[model samples]
Target chain A: MSESQQHHQSPGSPPASGLGLALFWVYVLLYIGFMGLVLVRPDLLSLRPFFGVNLAIVYGMGLIAAAFVLAVAYMVLRSGR
Target chain B: MLHETSIAAVTIFATFVLGVIGLSFFLGRKGQSASGYYAAHGQIHWFVNGIAFAGDYLSAASFLGICGMIAFSGYDGFLYSIGFLAGWVVALFVIAEPIKALGKFTFADALDSRFNSRGIKLSVAISTLVVSVFYLIPQMVGAGSLIKPLLGLPHEAGVILVGVTVTLIVVTAGMVSTTWVQFIKGSLLVFFCGVLTVLILGRGLAVNAGREGSENLTPQIRTVRPDGTVLVDGQPQSRDHDLRPVGTIIRLPERFAGQESTGPLGPLAYLATLEDSTIVTWATKKHADSEGVHTTYTPVERPGTELLKPGGFFKGLASGNLPDRLDFVSLMLALFCGTASLPHILIRYYTVKDAAAARKSTVVGIAVIGVFYVLTLYLGLGAMTSGALDPTDTNMAAPLLAKTFNETLFAIISAIAFTTVLGTVSGLIMAGSGAVAHDLVENVCGVRMTDHEKIRCGKLAAVGLGMVAMVLGILFRNFNVSFLVGWAFNIAASANLPALVMLLFWPRTTRQGIVAAVTVGMLASLTWILLSADTFEKVYGLSRDLALTPFSQPALITIPLGFLTLVVVSLLTPAPASLRR
Candidate 1:
C-alpha cells in the first residue's frame, strides 16, 4: 500500500479483513437458511422444538441471540489479535 | 377513534421537546467549526455513541409500529423486530471499521475517498438524500400520530411540530446535540420499555381482562366521510362517542380451563401459555360508499398456534404461491442488507474517533438493540391481551397498552416516543444536510466554501429537508409506520449497499462503476416501488391488479442488479490511474 493509503489504515490491531469477511458470511448463511425455511418448509417453524414454544419463536429469538454472540466473538477475536 | 387530549400527556410531551431543544442550545457553542457541526469533531465516546445508535435506530417504527403490529397481527410484527436487528450484523462485521477509516462527513465522502469523481459524489449524495427522505416519512408520520392523543392537534400539526423542532436541533448544534439527544432518548426508551414489560408480566394474562360488557363482542365500524367527518357505528365520533378499544383473551389452555386469569407468569411460561390460548383478534374489511370510506373491524377468535406463525401479515408465507413467497424473502433480504447502507446510520461512524471505537460502539448497539427487540414480543403479546387496542390505528397499540395500566405511565411512554421521533429526524436531517452542503455543493458543484459558509449551507439544507419531510409525512399519513420503513430499507439496500460493499471489497471497482451502481440501483428500486401493487392500491388509489411489478420489494432483484452493473461497467472501462498499480 502507498504511504497515504497506509495512513488511513485503522489503528489498534492489524486489519481483520479476513476475519470480518468470514464472520459476515457465517451470518449470511444463517440468515439465508432462515429465509429458506420460511419459504420451503415453513411448517417446520411451527413445531414445538423446545420449551413448549414453537420453532418459529425459538429460531427467531435465536437469530437475535446469535447476532449478539457473533458480535461479541468478533470483538474478542479482534482484540486478541 | 376520537382521542381526548390529556393535560398530563401535553405537559410531559412539551417538557420532553423543550428539554431536547434546551440541550441543543447548550451544546450549540461547540459546533462552530464545520467538523464539529458535521461530525461532532469525531469526539463522541464509544459508549455514548453506542447508546445513541440505539436511540437513532429505535424510532417510532421499532417502538410504536412493531408493538402495534405484534398486537394486531401476532408474530408477524416480531418478524420486523428480528429483521431490523439482524441488519446490524452486517453493519458490525462488514461496514463498521472501513466506514470509520474512509468517510469524513457523509456517506458520499466514503464513496468518493478513492476517486475524486464528481459523478460518484453527486450520485451517492443524491442517493443519501433520497434514502434520508424515505426514512424521514415514517418518523414524521409517527410524530403526527402521537400529537392527536398527546396534544389534541391534527396530524399535519404534529408533522409540522416535529419538523420545526428537529430543524432547530440540527441547525443549532448538528451532530453534537443530535448524538446526546439520541443517547438520552435511547436510554429512556429501553429503561421505560423494560418497566412496561415488568408491569405486563406482573399483570399476567386474563380472559376478558378489561371488557365490561357486550360492546367489544361484536364488529365495530369506523367511517370517514369525503368532507373528513368521522363516524363510529353510524354515530359521529366525539370524545364521548368513540370506537370501543378491542383485543382480548377469549379462552385459556386446557390445563387452565375455566380459570379467570393466570397470575404473573415467567417470560418463557408467558409465551408457552399464550401458545395454547384462544385470543380475539380483529380482521378489517373496507368499502367506499357515497357517505365515504367505511372500515369494519370484526372480531375473529384465533387459536394461539395460528397467531404465533409467520402467515398473519406476510400472507404469502401461508398461500404457498411462488410470487408471494418470493416477495416475503425479498423483504427480509432488504431489511438485512439495508441497515449498514442507511445514510443516517453510516454518518454515525464519523461521530466516534477510530475504527476500534466504531467496532466497540456497534457491539454496544447490538446488545442494546437486541434486548429491546426481544422485549417487543412480550410487549406486543401483552398489548394483544390488554384489551385496550385502538382497532383503527395499530400504531397506537403500545401507548394504549400502557394506558390500560395507568395514565401516568401512558403519558411518560408517549413523551419518550415523541423524543424518539425527534432523535431519529435530527439524525436524518443531519445526514441529508451533510450530503447537500459537504458533498453536492462543495465537491460536486465545485463551490468554494469556508468552514463558516459550509455550516451555514448545511443549516439551510436542514431547514429545507425538514419542510419536505413534513409535507411527505402529511401526504402519507395513513401508512403503517413499519410498512413504510420497509420501503426505505428496500431503497437503502438496493441503491447504496452494493456500491459500498463492492467499493470496499473489490479492487477493480472504478469510479464509473460506483456512479452507475448507485444511480441504477436507486432509480430501479424507486421505479419498482412506484409501480408495485401496494403503491397502486394504497398510494395511487387504484386496483392492485393494475400494478406493473410482480412484487412490492425490489431489493432481491435490484441489489444484484447494482452489483452486476458495477462489475460489467468496471471491466468494460480502462482502470483508473490509482487502480493501475
Candidate 2:
C-alpha cells in the first residue's frame, strides 16, 4: 500500500486493482457473446447492414472500439481511486 | 521491372539493418547486471514500453501474414487481426498488474514466488522454451519470405541472416537493446502503414485492364525441381525471376462497365464500390508428379459481396462440416486467451518499473494495436485491388501493394517488414535465454554462478535458440506464418494461461498442481497438433481421414483439460504450508 504513491520503494505494488479485474470479466463476456452469435446465427450476424457494411463488420469494429474504450475507462478509474 | 529485385530497395534495406545493429551496440554498455540484462533495470518509460509492447507483439505474422491473408481471402483474414487485438484485453485487465507484482525476471519467477520449488521452476523453464521456440519459427519464416523480394536472396539465407542478427542483439545488450529496438521499429511500422493506407485511399480502386481493357488475370504455375531451379509457367524464370505480379479487379458492376476504374473513391465508398464489383483471387493447388513438385496458381472470380463475408479462409464454417467448425472455434479460443500467456509478452511486464506502469503500458499497447488492426482492413482491401500481387506468394501482398505506388514506398515497406521480424525474434530469444540461465541452470539445476557467468550463460542460450529457429524456419517456409502463429497461440494458451490464472485467483493452487498442469498442457497441445488432420494432409502428405485427432486445433479440448488437471491435482494434494497464505 505504501508503494502506491511512491515509485521507487518496492519492486512492484501488490495487485488489488478491482477495476481491471472487473473489466476483465466484462470484456470476456462480451467476446464470448460475440463469438457465440457468429457460430449460432451467421446469417443474422451478416444480415444487419450499417454504413454500407454488414452487421459482422459493424460488430467487429464495435468490439475493437469497445476494447479501447474499456481500457481507457479502467485507466481513469484506477487513477481516480 | 516492377517486381524485379531493385538496387535502390536493397540499399535502403541494408541501411536500416546497419542502423538497428548499431543501436544495439550503443545500448550494450548499460546491461552489465542481471537485472539490467533481463529487465532493463525496470527504468523504461511507460509510454515507450507500451509502444515496445506493440512492437514485440505484432511480429511478422500480424504485419505481413494477416495483410496477405486478407488480400487473398477477404474478410476471413481481418478476423485474425480482430482476434489478435482482442487478446490484449486479457493482458491489460487480468495479467498486467498481477504479473508485474509477482515476478522479477521471468514468468517462472512469478509462478514460483509463493513456493521455491525446483520442480516448478524446471517445469516452467521448459514450458517457456517450448512456447518461445514455437513462436520464433513464424518470425523466422516471415523474414525468409520477405528477403526473397527485397534482396533477391534465397529463403534459407534470409533465415540465417535474421537468426544471426537477432542473436547478436540479444547477446550484446539483452533486454535494453531489445526494448529500444522494438520501440523504434513499432513506431516506424505503424506510421509507414498509416502512410500506405492514405496512399491506398488516394489512388482508389481500379479495374486492372493491364494497359488494355481486354486483359484478364490468368493463372501462373511454378515448378520446383530437385536441382533447386524454379520454372515459372513451364519456363525457367530469368535471372530476375519469372512469376509476374498479380491481384486486381478484372470486372466492374454493370453501372461502371464503360470505365476502367472507379478513381479516387472515399474509404467507405471504396468498400461499397468493391462490393458491387467482381475481383480475381488466386488459389494454389499442388501436384507432385514424376518431374517434381508442381504448384498451379489458379485465378477464381468472386463477387465483392461474397468476398466481404467470413467463410473463405475457414472452409469449415461455410461448408457446415461439424469437425471443421470445431477447429475454427478452437483456433479463435486460443487467440483470445493467448496474448498474456506468451513468454515474450509476460517478460515485458518486468521491463517497466511497477504495477501501475505496467497497467499504463498495457493500456497504451491496446490502443495502438487496436488502431493498427482497424487500418489493416483498408490496407488488405487496398492490396486486393492493388494490381501488383504475386499470385504464388500471398505473403508479398503488402509490399507489392506499396509497389503499386512507387519503388521507394515498396522499399520502405519491405525494410520495415524485415524490422518487424527482427524486433520480435530478439524478444523471443531474450525470453528463451532467461528461461535457460535463470530458471533451468540456477534455480532448477542448483548451479551457482557469479553475476558475470549468468550473462554469459544467457548469451549462449540466445545463440543456440537462434540457430534452432533458423533451421525450423527454413523447413517450414511453405506454410503461411499466420497459420503457424495460431498453433503457437494454442500451445501458449493451454500450457501457460491455465496455471497463471489459477495461481493468481485460486488460493488452493499447489506447486505440484502447476507443474502437472504446465507439463500436461504443453505436451498435450504439441501432440494434438502433430496428429491433426491439417498436419497430416499438409506436412505428411496423407489423407485427412487418417489423422488421429478429430479436429486440427487443440485449444477447445486442451485448455479446459489444463484447468481440470490443475484443480483436481490441487485438491487431491494438500497445499504446502509454505505456499498457504
Candidate 3:
C-alpha cells in the first residue's frame, strides 16, 4: 500500500519524446475525423447487407486505414526527430 | 468431418501443448512465491506483456465464436468485430496507463486505492470471480467442442482435458506461465488466420453446383414452443445428441455476392462492398420438432446475382427496423466497452513492467487484433460459400470451411481452436486465483501469510475454480459458444468497467460508493439475464416468449445503470478526510 503512493507519470503526460506527442495528436485527430465521416455519411458505413443488417465494413476499413496513417505519421515524426 | 487426425495436426497440437507446459514450468519456478504466482511479481517486459494481452484477449470467443457468427450471419456478425476493436481504443486511451500505474493483483487494488475498505475489496473481488467464471465457462465449453471434433473424443473428455491442463498451468506457475502461453497462442492465431485469409482470397469464390443434398436434409431443427422444451423434428432432443447432421448448401450458378475482386477477394475487396450495390436480406422461419421455436433465415441472394448467400442465426436482427437496430447497437456497445473492463484482461496489464510498456503493448495488441478481425470476414465468407456451413453449429463453420479447402488445414485450425481455449482459460484461472488469494484472503481477511503461503493458497483456489469451470462446461455442453460469451461481456461491462473507470478518472470516488455500485450492478445484471425470457427458455428450460426482458442481452439497460449508480452513490458519500492524500 505504501508503494502505491509514489507519484508515477500522470496518465495524460506526453510520451518521453517530444515527437511522440505530435504523432499521438495526429492519430487522435485522424480517428476522430474518420468517426465523423461515419456519423455524417452512414451510407458509406454499410458494405454488406443481408436482411437489412449493414455490415460495418466501411467503418472497420476506415479505422484500419486510419491506423495505418497513424503508424506512418509516427514513423515520419520519429525520423524527423 | 470423418478425416483421420494426421501426423501434422497431432505434431502441431502436441508440440504447442508441450511447449506451453515447458514454459509454465520455467515461469512456474519464481511463481512459487505468491506475488510471482498471481501477478508475475509485476515485472514482465512491456513487449511480452503486450503480446500476452493479445493472447489473453483473443479467447475461443474471438476465434471460434465470432468467426462462426460472422460466417452464418453476414454483415451483422462483423459488427461484433468493430465493437470488440473499438473497446481496445477505449482501453489504450483511457485505461491502460492508469491501470498499470495504480494497481497490483486484482482490479480491487486500483478501486480500493484511496480507502483501504474491506468492503470494496470483498465486493470487487466477488465481481471479478463471478465475471471470470462466466467467461471461463465458454472457454471450457469451446475446448470440449474443439476436442470432440479434433481428437474424436467426447465433450466430457474435452472439458476434463482443459480443466486439468489449465489447473496445472495455474497451480504450477500462475501468471508467469499464463502470460507466455497467451503470448504464444495469440501470435500463432493472428499469423495462421492471416495465412488462412490469404488462402481464402486466393482460392476465390466459385459455385460448387455439383453438390447434392443429403438424404435426410433433416436441418437439425429446434422448435421452441411458448414453453421451452427444445425438440428436434417432432421429438425432444437431448443436448447429448451432438451427432446431429445439417442440410447441405448447394451454390446456385451466379458469382459470389459480396466480392469486389474478379478472381477472389483480397483483404481490400471484402471491405469494398458498399461502393456499388445495396446488400439485400430477408428472413423466414422454419419449425423444428414439436417445439415451435422460429429460426430466422437470411436468403443470401444479392439483387442481380444468381448465387445466394445463406445467412443463418442473426439474419433476423439485420432486416427488422428500430428495435432490431437497438439490439445491434447494444451488443456492439457491450463488446466495445467490455474488452477494457474484463477482470482477466485487466490483470494482464500488471504482468507487464511499467506504464509505458502497457501502453505500447496495448498498441501492438490493437494492431494484431485488428488484423485478425479483418481476416475473420474472409474466413467467414469463405466458409459461407465453401459448402461447409453447419446450420446447426455455427461455431464449427470456420474450421469446416478450412476443411473444404484442405484436410490438413482443417486439422491445424482444429488444434488451434483447442489452444484458443487453453490460452483463454489459463488467463481466466489466473484472474480467479488472484481474486481469491490476492484480494480476498490476503487483503480483506488481513492474513499475515508469507509469500510461500500466498502462492500455496492461490494454487488451491485455481484448482477449485477449474473444477467449477469443468462442471459448468460439461453441463452447458450444447449452448452455442458465441451466445454464452455475450453474457460474459455483459456482466463484465456492467459490474467492473463502471467502477474501474470512475475510480481512475474521478478523485471523489469513495470506497462505499465503489462497493455498492459493483454489488448492485453485478447482481442486477445477473438477475436481469436470468429472469429474461431468453435465459428462461434457452438456459433454464423455460419459455422465451414468457420471459420479461424483450431481449436477452442486458447491455443496453445494465451498462448505463452501472455508470449512473457509481455517479449517484459517489455524489452522496463524501470521501474520508484521510483518503484525500
Candidate 4:
C-alpha cells in the first residue's frame, strides 16, 4: 500500500491480517447472532430480569466481551507485526 | 417569575457571544477559501476534532433534556446515554474511514462517489436539508428554552439571539469558527457537568423539607362528578377540586447494593401522587368560555428519610417490566445509533484530515461523551430529590438542583447552555449550507462557481438556514424539544445510515440505488411522522387515534426498510469497474 493509503486506513480501519479478518468476521457474526437472539427470544439469553439484564443487555455485554477477547488475543499472537 | 434575566447571566451570555464573534474574525483569514470555509482545510487536530465532536453532539438534548428525563424517569434516562455512545461504534468501526476517503464537502459526495449522477446529488441534498432542518428545530427551540430560564427573556428573543449570533459565527468563518465554538462549548459543558456531579456526590442526598416561609397547611382536594358539582364518593362535597388530595410526601433513599455507591448519603427520594402525576390530562373545558380554567396540580413531597435510598424511578426501571424496559432500550438505541448517523455529525469528518484522524477523533469524542453521560446520571438523580423541580418545567431540574447549592454555579451552567445552542446550531447551519452550496447550487444546478463563489454562497445559505431555524425555534416553543430531536435522529439514522454504509461496503451499490434509498428513507420517515397520531394531535389539532401509524416513533420499521431498499436496488444495478474496487 502507498504511504497515503496506509495513513487513510490506520486506526479503526477494517481488519487486514488473515487472523484479524477471521476474528472480525467472527465478531460480526456474533453481533448479528446475538442481536437476532435478543429480538426473537429475549428470555432464552438469561434469567436475570430484575437487574435490567434482558436479551439486549446480554447481547450488548456479549459484544463488549467478544471485542475485549479479540483485542487481547491480537496483542498476544501478533506482537511482531 | 423566572430568575433568568439576572445581570450575571446577561453579562456571561454577552461575553460568550462576543468571544465567539471575535474568534470568527480571527479565524476568518483561514476560512477565505471554499475548502477552508467548509472543511477547515482538513487540518484540525484529531483530539481537537474529537472534543469538537462532543461539542457538536451534546446539544440541549444532552445537557437539559436527558438530565430532565433522568431526574423524572430514573434509569430510563441513562438508557439515552448508552444508546448515544453506542452509535459511535458504527462511526468508528463502519463509517469513519470510508466517509473520509470518499466524501469531500457533504454526505452526498460519499454516496455519489461511484457514479457522477445528478439524480443522486439532488436526492441526497434534499435529504440532508430535511434532516438538518428537523435537527435545527430542536437546537433552536432549545436555545429559546434556555434563554427563557437563563436570560429571563422571551422565547422569541432567545431564538433570535441564538439565530443572529450563530449566523454571524457561520457566515464569518464557516466551519472553522463552528468547529472551535463547538470545541469550547463541548469542553465547558463536560467540565461544568463534572463539577456539578462532584458537588452532588459531596453534598450527598438530603430531604429538602418543603419551603420554610409558607404557612404549613394540609393540601385540600375534592372529587367532582361528571357534572359541575364537586362530589366525594357518592355525595357532593364542598371543596375546590374533585379528587381528594394526598398530603403526605413519598420518600426514596439511595441504596448501595454493591461497592459502587460512595457519594454522601442522606435522605433522597422522588415524590408524586400515583394517578394525578402519572396521568397527563387534557382539559375537557370548552373554548371561548367567559372564564377559562387553568391547569391545577397537587404537590408530591419527598420525606427527609428517603433521600438516602434509591427507589422511585430507578426502582420502576429496574423492576424489569416490558413496556418500561422497552421504552428505555428503544430510546437508548436511538441515542447510540443516532449520533453516528446524524447529518451534522457526518459533516464534521470532512473538517478533519484523513480517515485515520477521523477514527481517532471518534474514539476521543466517545471517551469525552461517555464520561459526560456518566455525569448526567449523577446530576439527574441528585436533582430528582433536590426539591427544586418546577412542576411546569422538568428541564430546569438540573440547573435548579445546582441553585440549591450556589447561585454562581447556576449562572455558569445557564450561560454554558446558551453557548451550547450556538455551538450545535452553528454546526447544523454549516451542514445545511453545505447541502445548499455543494449539492444544490453546484452539482444539481450545474453552476460552475469558483471556490470563492462557493464560500460566498455557503455563507448566504448559512444565514438562510439560520433564519429558518429561528422561525422554527419560535414556532415549536411548546413542544417537547428533546422528543422532537428523537424524531430527527430516527430520520437521520434511517435516511443516511443505509446509503452511506452500502456505498462503502457494496461496490454494486449504484448511484440510482443510493438516491432511491435516501429519498425513500427520508420521505418515508418524514411523511410517517407528519401523518402519525402525535403530529395530528399536536400540530394539526386532530384526534391522535385517527392517525395512521400504530405508534409515534418510526425507527424500528423505517430503518430496516431503508437498508432493504438499498440492498435490493443495488442488486439490480451494475457498477463501472473503475468505480468498483
Candidate 5:
C-alpha cells in the first residue's frame, strides 16, 4: 500500500554487470550443448558405460550438478569482488 | 483417485490443512505495511526465501506432471526437470541482482523502474494476469486429483476445497504467510520424497509377475466404448469396471535371468539393470465407432533400452521429422525461458533485502531445486516399476506408488501433495493480486490509492482470482490434457522474456517497443496454441489434420517475433521525453 521508494541499489548503475553476463553465457552454452546432442546426435546422449550408467543419464545428472557448482562458484566470485 | 479412502489419509489431510491455515493467521499479523504485505518488507532471511522459491516453483506440474510423464515415458520426462532447473541459472545470474535492485513489489515495478511508462505497466500487468491464470488452472486441476483419493470427494469438491483454502490463506496474510508456507512445504516435500526414494531403492527392481490373481504376465486390453461403456478383453465389463490397473515387469535382464530379484542396486545401477529388463508399458488407441468413442488401452512389453530413449514420450524426436523436431526444441526453449519469465517467480525476488541476498537466495534455490529434480527421476522411475500404476490417470503415479509400499507412506505423500498444491496456489494468487492491485489498478489505471487501500484491493483481487481458478479447475477436471501447461510456458517466454531481456541488455528499446512486443508476443502464442493440432484433437474434438499451425509449440516463432517486434518498433519511433538516454 505504501508508495515510498525501497529499492536497494544505488540509482545510477544497472544490476546486470560483467560477471553476471559471463555466467549467463556459460549456462546458455551448456544448455545448447545438451539440446544439440538431443537434436543432432541423440545417440551421443545414450553413449554408455560411464560408472555403469548411460551417457544421457550421466549428462543429465551432470547438468544439474554443474549448475550447483557454478552457482557456488558465482558466490565465490561475488564474495571475492 | 487411484487409492482407497483410508482413515490415515483423512487424518493427515485434515491436520495438514488446519496447520497451514493456522500458520497463515499467525504470520498475517506483522505485514501491515504495503511493502510488508506485498514483499515481506524485504526482510525475509535469504535461506528461507531460497527454499520458498522451490515451494512456489514446484507446482503440481513439477511433482505430479513430470513424475507421471517419466513414469509413463522414460528419459524424456526428466528433460522437463532439466529445462526447469536450467531456468534458475538464468534467474540467478542475469535476472536476480538486477531484478532485486529494480523492483519494489511487483514484477512490473522492475520493468517500469527506469522508464516509468504507463504503457509498459499496462501490457506487463495484463500479461502477468493472463499467464498467472493459465498457470493456476493446472495447479487447481492437480488439487482436484490430490483430494479425490484422500477425502473420497468428487473432483469438483476437491477444486473448491483448494480454492477456498488458498483464498483464505492469501486474504489473511499476503506474502508474509505465503513465504513461510512455501518454505515449510518445500522442506517437507523434499524430505519426504527423499525418504520415499530410499524406500524404493531398498526394495530394488523386481519382475512383478502380476498381482496375485492376475498372474498372467501377458498384456490385457480394455476398450472404452463411445457410449462410455467399458469392454475388457472381448466382453463388456460389469458395472464396477476398473481399467485392470496396469504396469509390470514381464521379464528380467539376461544377467538376472534365473533370479526373481536383482537384490539391492545403487542409483545408477538401478537404471542400468532396468535397461536390460523387459517391462510392460501401456499404449492407447482411440477411434469413433457407431456414434460412440472407443478407446483401447493395450499393455505392450518393451526392452528397457527403448524406454530410456528421448523419443518414447516426445513423439517428435521419435518421429525423426524436421517440423516435429522443431516443436520439441521450441517446447524445451519455452521450459528453459519460462521460469525466469513467470510473474509468480519474478515477484519472489522482492522478498529478499538486496541484490546480494537475491543472488544468494537464487543460488540456494538452485541447489535445493537441483537436488529435488534429481530425486524426481528416482521417484518417477520407481513409480514406473512399482507395478501399481493407474493407466487411466498418470497424475496419480507418486502417491499411488507410495500406496504400493504402505498405507502410511501413501497418507503422508498425499498430505504433502495437498500442501504442495496449497503452497503453489497461494504464491500464484499473490502474484495475480499484485498484477491487479499494484500494477494495473495503481499504475496503469491511474488510480492512486493509499497503502491501506492497495491491500484492500489486492485481497479483493485474490478472492476474484481464486474464484476464477476454482471454476476452471472444476470445468477441466475430466480433461486428460497433461502437457497443456506447456501453453503457459510458451506464452510466458514469448511475451515476458523478450521485454525483460531487451530492457536489461538493449539500450534503445522504447516504451512503445516494450508494450508492443508484449502484446504481440502474448497474442501470437495464445492464438497459435488455440489453433494447434493438439488443441484440434484434444480440446476442440475435431480432426487434428484440420489444424492451422505447422506444429503445436509457438516459441520458435513467437520468441523471435517478440525481439524483432521490439527492434523494429524501437527503430521507427522516437523516444519519449522521459526515456531519452
Candidate 6:
C-alpha cells in the first residue's frame, strides 16, 4: 500500500490540541453546574426565571444547546488550522 | 390494557421489516471482504454516517423508553434526555478524532493500537461484549413492547422477531447494510417525531381531552391468575375487557379556569400552561390474593409545577434522603460518561474515512439528536395529557398517544418504532460480533484466518448474540426499558471510559494499566449492580431492604475507582519506552 493510503487506514493520533480540550472543559463545567443545582438547591431550579418555564427546563435545554454550539466552534476553529 | 390486532399496523410493520431485510440483501454483496463487513470499508459519506450515528445511538431506549418515562413521571424523564445528549459532547470533543485515527474495526483496536498487547485486547474485548449485551436487553424489551400494541402479539414473539431480523441484517451485510438501515431509520424517526411534535403544539392543551363521557374515574384492578388466565375489574380479560385509558388534565390554569381548552399554544406557552394545570397521573400497587396477583392503578392529581420539576419518577429528589439522592447523581454521571464508552458508538468512528470525518459526523449526530431530545419534552407532555396512557405499560405511551390522534399516525409511528429497534439491534450485534471474531478469536486467541473465514466467523458470532439478546429481553420484560438502559450506561461508563480517557491524555498509562482498569471497572460495576436494591427487588424478586448495596446506580463510585486503578497500576508498572518523554 502507498504510504498516504496506509496512513489513512492506520493513522496515529496527533498531539492533543488546546482548543478541543478547552471546549470540553467548558461543557464539563456546564454539565456539572446543572447536576450540582439539582442536588444542592433544586428549589432554585423550580423558580421560573423567564418564559414562564422553570430554571430546570431552561438550564437543561441550555446544556443541549451549548453542546451543539461548542461542537460547531471546535469544528470551525480546528478547520481554520 | 388490551390491544386488538390492526390490519393497517400489521401491514405497515411488515413492509418496514421486509424493506430493511431486502436492503440488507442488496448490500450483502459488497460486504464480502472483512474490511467492508466490519467498517463499510471506511468510505461512507460524512453526512450519511452522521445520520447513521443517530440511527445507531437512538435505540428503543431513547425513543420509547425516554418518551414513556417523561409521559409517566414528568421532568425526571427529560433528565435522561439531557444526560444522553451531553455524552455526545465528550464523543465529539475528546474521543471522536482519536478513536477514528487509531481503530480499524472494534473499540479494542483503538485501545490496543499503542500497546499491541494480548492482555489489552482480551480485556477490552470482554468489556465490549458485556456492555453490548447489557445494552441489547432494553432494545429487545422495547421491541416486545411495540409488537404487543402494533401487532397484538405476545412480548416474547416480538423479542424473537427482532432478534431473528437483526441477526439476519448483521449476518447478511454487516456494517454496510447496518449503516444504510440506520440512516433510513434515523431520518424517519426524527422526521415523524417532528411531525408528531407539531401536531401536539397545534392541538394544544385540553381539559380532560379524550375523557368525554368517562365520568367514572375510579382506579382499575387487573389480576393475573396462577393458571395463566387474566382478569380486569373481576371480569375475564379480552379484547372488550381491560383497564380504562388514563392521563389527562383535571383542571387548567387559574387564568384559563372553566375553559375547556387553551387553543393552540406555542412551545413556551405549552410549558407555561402545563405548569399551572392540575394533571392526573397514575400510581400502581400490587398484592397477592386468593384469586391471583392483583394490581391496582390509582389516579393521583399532581400540580404541573411539581411534575415539571426533578422528582416524580426519581423519588430521590422528592424524598431528599442521602442514599436516594446519591443514586440519582450516580445515574446522571453514568449517562454523561457512557456515550463515548459504548462499543457500538466507538466502532462507528472506524466507518468514516478519517479523523476529520469522524469529528464532523459527531457534530452532525449531536444536531440531530439534540433536536429529537428537545421534541421529546413536548411529545411526552402531550401524551401525559392526551388521556390515552395504558396503566399497565408505560413503554407504550408514545405509540398510544399517536393512536389518540389517528389510527394511521399510530400505524406509521409504531412501524417506525419497530424499525428503530431493527436499526439499533443490528448495530449492537455488529459490535458484539466484531468483539468475538476480530478481538477475541484473531487477536486474543491468536487464531489466523483468511478474509472469507473472518466474515464467516463474525456471522456466527452475530447469530449467537441474537439468541442471547432474545433470552434477556424475555427475562426482563416487566422493568421499564429506560430503567434497564441505565444499568447499561453504568457498566459501559465504569468499565470502558476510564481506560480510554487515560490512554489518550495521560502519558504514564501502561499496557498492564489498561487491562487492569477495564477488568476492575467491569467487575466492580457488575458486582455493585447485582447487589443493588433495584436488582434485589426487580431481578431476584426479593425485598429491597435485604439488598447489600446502599444505593442502586454505581457509576459515582465505580467510575472513579476505574481511574484510580489505572493511575495506581500505571505508576507501579514501567512505562513503555515509546511513551517516555
Q: Better model by DockQ, 2 or 5?
A: 5
Clashing pairs in 5: A1-B34, A1-B451, B226-B292, B226-B293
Please provide, for model 4 over B1-581, each residue's C-alpha lDDT reduced to its tens digit, 9 standing for 90 to 100. 23535677677777877887899889888898998988999989988999999999888877887787766654446555555655666666667666777778898887776678999999888888988899888788777777776777788998999999999999999888889999999999999998887777676533222333322233323333344554333344433323322122132223422322234532121111111112111111222222321233445443322221222333324364554444334444455456667778998988887765776677678677767876776787667655565544556667777777777787788778878888998998999899999999999999999989999999899989989999988898766566778888888888888887676656567677888888888888888788876799878878977898765667766777888998888777776455555
lDDT by residue for model 1 (B331-430), tens:
8989999999999999999998888888999999999999999999999999998888888787888888888898889999999999999999999999
Docking class of 2: acceptable
Candidate 3 structure quality by residue, lDDT tens digits, B1-581: 22245667667667767777788887777776766787888888877787888888888878888887765555546556666776776677667767777777878887776677899999989999999989988888888777755676777998998899889887888888888888888888888898888887776544341244322323334456768655555466555542233222332223445433336554555334212332322234654444366564443344312111212344333254444445555666687678878999888878776665676677778788778877876776666556555565567877777777777888778777777888899999888888898889999899979888888888899999999999999988877777788788888888888888777656667777788789887998899888886679768887666887766678888888988898888888887564555
Interface RMSD of each: 4.2, 3.2, 7.7, 9.0, 3.5, 2.6
Docking quality level of the chain pair in candidate 5 = acceptable
Q: Which order, best to worst by DockQ? A: 6, 5, 1, 2, 3, 4
TM-score of each: 0.97, 0.96, 0.83, 0.80, 0.95, 0.98
Q: What is the full ranking by TM-score, best candidate first?
A: 6, 1, 2, 5, 3, 4
Point out the worst 10-residue segment of candidate 6 chain B by lDDT: B209-218
Going through the candidates in order, what is chain B's TM-score? 0.99, 0.97, 0.87, 0.85, 0.96, 0.99
Instruction: Compare candidates 1 and 2 on DockQ and give the better one.
Output: 1
State residue B440's C-alpha deviation in candidate 1, in Å. Answer: 0.9
Quick one: RMSD of model 6? Answer: 1.9
- Candidate 6 at residue B405, lDDT? 87
Which candidate has the highest DockQ of all?
6
lDDT of 6 by residue, B159-208 (tens): 99999999999999999999999999999999999999999999888888
For candidate 4, the per-residue lDDT at B321 reads: 57
Predicted model with the maximum lDDT: 6
The DockQ for candidate 6, computed on C-alphas, is 0.53
Clashes of each: 0, 1, 10, 28, 4, 0
lDDT of each: 0.90, 0.87, 0.70, 0.68, 0.85, 0.91
Residue B129 accuracy (lDDT) in model 1: 95
Model 4 error, position B321 (Å): 11
